[model samples]
Target: MEKLYEVFPCSETQKVLLATYTLKDEARRDQKVSEFQELKQGRMSVAEYEAKFTELARFAPHIVDTDYKKARKFEGGLDLEVFDRVGVQKLPTYVEVLDRSLMAEATLAAMKQGKAPATTTTEWRGKRSGFGFKKGRSFVSKKQNTRTSNSSSQSSGSIPVCSDCGKRHRGVCYRVSGACFRCGQPGHVVKDCPP
Candidate 1:
């Protein structure tokens, strides 16, 4: 029953970055949002955030060749926790809060924080009905699961493990787009970067 808005930044830029993208990917993208608290109601993509952060830095601080060096300087900039971003959707496509307790807590807190009451709220609906989360079954297809099982059975300790970090990272999968959702990088197989 945790609230997404309460813990995240008010800037949608940072919010979307944290929500849609990953900390590991952020450095590569060059979108630096070091602090989760700094997020506001901005919905620029991670690509956009990376672009703007660089532009602003150009005028004032100037650019350094070492991106890794810069990333290290910006600690706490990325919140890559799975729960923080699970079920996350990009802006202009915000999902409605279905949980009543979460709604009450956020609304009440907003009032005290000098925000206007959310007296008028819209219910979340998708393009098709009966197309939301359900407890018993997953949204995945049976064929997908069968295919995944076949692949894994074929690859018992015979392939690379770590999808991103490489070097056989334990417990994570190499196929993010496939059945292997190790640490959840989007498309690339963990063993091989997308080409």
Candidate 2:
């Protein structure tokens, strides 16, 4: 406030005209309009956004300026989803856009509370709750599966299975390439298995 007062330095004789009530009001209004242009909804509630809009609009009559620049500026401050839904191209007038945005906001609030909007055919209850993965489904590598099948047919009894990689105990397990535990060798495991 002191800085603003210092900015418009005028002699005491000229102060009466510059610091008049009307001039001060106009300056305040101009500041309000400037703030309105840079406004962003962010995490503000719909009511808070509307209140700010209304407060700023009262100060700036040009908020309904020609070519709808003011309207576009107002819409730009809204949430991206709301802006995309009821932008200048979509809505015919600023009034319509404002109305649609309010309605959309209400619908979104309803959805957050696990209630479907009036337009929704299916009931909304937040996100679907269930196990992350589907039941009766498991991964089986093709190479491992083929090798397991071959070993099952070749071996008379149960074939050895590694606890780590879950693959048949060949010369080298599928995952572990070197340092075979069986023979304690680098390149090979127990038997001279086929590549």
TM-score of each: 0.22, 0.45
Strongest candidate by lDDT = 2
What digit string (tens of lDDT, one per residue) describes model 2 on residues 36-130? 77778888865588678777776666665643665566677889877776674565445545556766676566557664344221211111221
lDDT score, candidate 2: 0.57
Give the Å error, residue 109, model 1.
27
**Candidate 1 stretches greater than 4 Å from native:** 1-42, 62-65, 73-144, 147-195
Candidate 1 lDDT, tens digit per residue, 1-195? Answer: 027668753676767666555655656435443332243214543334445545544433433335433332222222233113322421121111112112333344445666443212121131123232223654434455455445545544543355565654222233422532333344445466442
Question: Which pairs, if any, clash in model 2?
Answer: none
In candidate 1, clashing pairs total 18
Error of 2 at 154 (Å): 64
Per candidate, the number of residue pairs that clash is 18, 0
